[model samples]
Target: MRLIEGTYGIAVLHADFPDRIVVARNGSPVVLGIGEKEMFVASDIAALVAHTRQIVTLDDGEMATLKADDFRTYTTEGTRTTAEPTTVEWEAASYDMGGHDTYMHKEIHEQAEAVDRVLRGRIDDRFSTVHLGGLNLDAREARRIRRVKILGCGTSYHAGMIGAQMIEELARIPADAEPASEFRYRNAVVDPDTLYIAVSQSGETYDVLAAVQELKRKGARVLGVVNVVGSAIAREADGGIYVHAGPEVCVVSTKCFTNTTVAFALLALHLGRTRDLSVRDGRRIIEGLRRLPGQIAEIMEQEEEIKKLALEYAEARSMLFIGRVRGYPVAREASLKLKEVSYIHAEAYPASELKHGPLALIEPALPTVAIVPDDDLLEKNRAAMEEIKARSGRIVAVAHREQEKADHTVVVPKNEDELDPILLGIPLQLLAYHTALALGRDIDKPRNLAKSVTVE
Candidate 1:
């Protein structure tokens, strides 16, 4: 226990151990301590309720003066703070069935609307001009950016990978997606003219923050594409685009990934237009963006089929995901979601590279998820699917149109090949979610993982 006296002779008595108290700069106190293994208390009941149904939140300015069989509390400065039992009636239904059976299902259904919201009011119908309020760069500055560096972690990093392909192809700028952790540790070349875009859902990923700060130190212009309104990254970046996906309570991200990718597409297209991109091409992309939401909703209605597939594959010991070009990133994210939520051993590979290796792991019992959007590489991917099939591999193909090459087809709604990742991504996310549910794993708070990795 310690007593601290402040500037106004405001004496504060703190009794809990340092680790048990979640202290903020604003002097908010969050008590996280255990009376017994079966008894726990915290500022937020959700953190402890899983361990013990009985819980309490310490009031502001209160000092937990007594620690025994019963609870006692007092004010920080010689006054008494009242203690009360707050009746928090938490309904699981709040997170369940917003419009679907599971949170993941609801989240998948929300993607189309989410994409529309991200694109709303940001594009001009003519597609000849672009306006990004936070991007202080004018046409000249935007045109001068010859290279782009995207930094993020997990699903966001995969989105960055897709962004790189889009930016390079549409905007005609060379782009590379680097994992923030690896980017920070390496000796990277950055300059004032370089446009560094940091992608994160929480806006407070430690490695991303550190990498952006390092880039700024080298005088590179930093832009952040994040979901949270007032996150550390959002506040720190020179320019930022909000995903506006709302509070994603689930640890395995679904809506946020689609939102981020769509937002990046808008940004890339905007930059492309500003840099003298062909007017026809720009209009085509804008039209595709406008149509993405409806396509997403169409795909969401296939939940029952996806769930059934999940149940059928629930016993699979190992899974492989394959994709090429933009699909590679989707494959990576799909593999990550499966591993994180379902505890399934899943790995992603570029379809072409499977011939060199990974093909050896293919068997009738193993499941292979191929992200085969109807793109230029569709034929090659089909060829790869043939190899998996020859090896007796169970194929769960995520494609726009059903190809008879796979054992089970998860049909993604039709979209421009460049935009297929946004639609194709949903089914895989749902597959992982349903599989996790079948395995009876925690859907929101996965084991040993925090919603935001705020600390290094």
Candidate 2:
């Protein structure tokens, strides 16, 4: 008899006892694949698409034991139960690394296609609305939502910051983002009139899952903006929209971040139209969303230049990233990518926060990357660039136009002010990729990090 303790979503396939296997899940995902004489278990369906499309998704507090062709399941309460295996339509090619050197590079280049995938069939041009099947909110209900709270961890939390900005901008909803880890432990007041969004690429992030469970337990509705289908958060949340960014194998998230931001734009557009947003503005946002794939492709063409820049800065000991408003989250995520893969000590601060305390750290040896959006805050961002320049700091600016104040400028294609983050972030992803490549770091599997953080 095998003893299974607490809720650590685990799947075991005993090669010694080939036929005997045990699977248990809670707040994480486990899929079981039944083959002719073999069996498989994985955290993601992408891993099992090669062998079998038919799979069983184990729910929270559920356990199953398999012996070749026979299987039995039991609830955490010791009651006998049954789970149905469903057929997935995902193609095997989705998981392949293709010809890229690493999964990170492949995923970075896939951003264009990934963004297009998220926007493909969701927009309704005729009615100036969006159809997010998993939102589970109607026109009347969406209009009634007074406030929106987005929760996530790491990269997802950064995306949530961007999402909250978009929601507040377009939908005019009082929106904000919080780290799921903190949100769950704070004894948050669950309001029925507020929309709660849990953003995660795997949908199995422990903190995010725990937050979702807590919200659900408190009788508050939750929506999941997740990439992986049939993940714990996806299945447990009242409803949600799939990011459809495909499988991200790299430890540092790339495509999922961009695609999730695009997904947020779609969500924002949907919410905006439900309220008093004019048709003209909604159409403009829709058109901007449609143009992202091409814009991303255009920005990626500068990879050679970015690589050269990375090589130039490869010897740098540390880095600083700063931006204002929408660009703030981009700075945070870009800094994360750089540190995660390149192992460089990096910090991201809001441009407004620099003078308050971070200004003391600026120096000639350290490089600064500033996001200068061609919006109302353009002058403020330029002023921040000047501040870094005053400290003799080398500045690399990602902006819609060449920044005269920056030492070097990487110009990205301009989009609407609200949509600028989606476009402005692409070059930084390339910057991180090329920087790590120049430093000869393990690009796909970063040291001391896993692709998914299943444990708290």
Candidate 3:
């Protein structure tokens, strides 16, 4: 296991010696759990928490030997390592369905509470700022940050895109997001003045972890925005925000995605406060953050309506999702959720780009989902919907007001424009769930996709 060249985790059961089990990991995670008269090993802690919270995490180059009553940890180089077991705080029932039919459905509803958990004890009302205790960077280091580069993959990448926009708008920093999968292969430039942030739901994503290592080796400062306490990326990064979304058993992300965006909002708020952001404006954002939990629950109230829309769209051959600016990332994530859970073909495009290419696909048979936040982009989005309606395409808009041109509308409660993306996303989760249900697809475990991509 020590000489393994790539990301791998293996467990071997000796046929002759049934009592002994050997497990090793290179780039992947391995957790050994201790229980009364039993032992367990899994790639994720969520699986082990149900039986035993006392567990030991194996590092990249570590291997372990397990027995019914005891376990031993060591390096593959024939050196012994101390295997200390620590008790995780989560309960066994965290993984349960809690009366929901599927984990996706449960997580969708959990967003309100999950978001509140992420916001708890983090806001500074007196200073009108956000206080992230885990972020090791102080005001001095933060003031030196000239740019922001957020790296992640899939859904995490989308969240980073939103974070970048917030930082650029609020803190006046040059910010952008890059897919971590391609970051290492391209030999990315590491700028000392640029604050690098790695985002991950599992904190065990292999691509993000590798990118962090490469950045550190080049003498760049990096932080992490991650879930799962003590996971690989969480352990490796200099400092970051712990998005407390709790146990998400669903393969498709819902609560974590929302929590991560809120986490970014906090980071952006903190950075902004250190710079030119005023106390008044910071209080506005802070108030907006407080309103999210109630607003999310309000959106969840529309589940039956969204389910109807899902059933209608589920019969389509394909779907188109569109938004402008901040809403663009929302469109992309919504498209991803729909495709992932419902197995439907979906494409997201910036509203401005429709006339350039995607406009050709508009027709009556195809449905369009538009994110039309009532911000500065309202008129532009309305114009795009007019364009789609001109082509006889049926439209469903997620917006603050009912769209005149849209055949159907998913009305969302408005917040600060920077915070609109958080609320606009909740209904789409329900859409994906009911659509998958209508199609009889497996909602929790989508085929060919793992909850965490540990292997590159």
Which window of ten consecutive residues has the lowest lDDT sum in model 2?
1-10
Q: How accurate is candidate 1 locally (lDDT)?
A: 0.76
Off by over 4 Å in 3: 15-20, 36-38
For each of the candidates, the C-alpha root-mean-square deviation to the true structure, in angstroms, is: 8.6, 1.9, 1.5
Colliding pairs, model 2: none
lDDT of 1 by residue, 1-456 (tens): 144432111223366542232222112224333445333444333454344434444433445543335555565555655555443333334344575555666676778777877787788877654467876777888888979999999888999998888888888899989899899998887766678999998776777877988888888899999886545577679987988775566778899999998888888888888886899988888888888888888777888999999999988998999999888999999999999889999999999999898898888888899988887888999999999989888898998778798988988777666677878878888888889899998877788787666545
- The list of candidate 1 runs beyond 4 A from truth reads 1-102
Q: Give per-residue CA lDDT, model 3, range 160-200, as digits (tens).
A: 99999999988999999999999989987788999999999
TM-score of every candidate relative to the true structure: 0.80, 0.96, 0.97
Higher-scoring candidate on TM-score, 1 or 2? 2
Candidate ordering by TM-score (highest first): 3, 2, 1
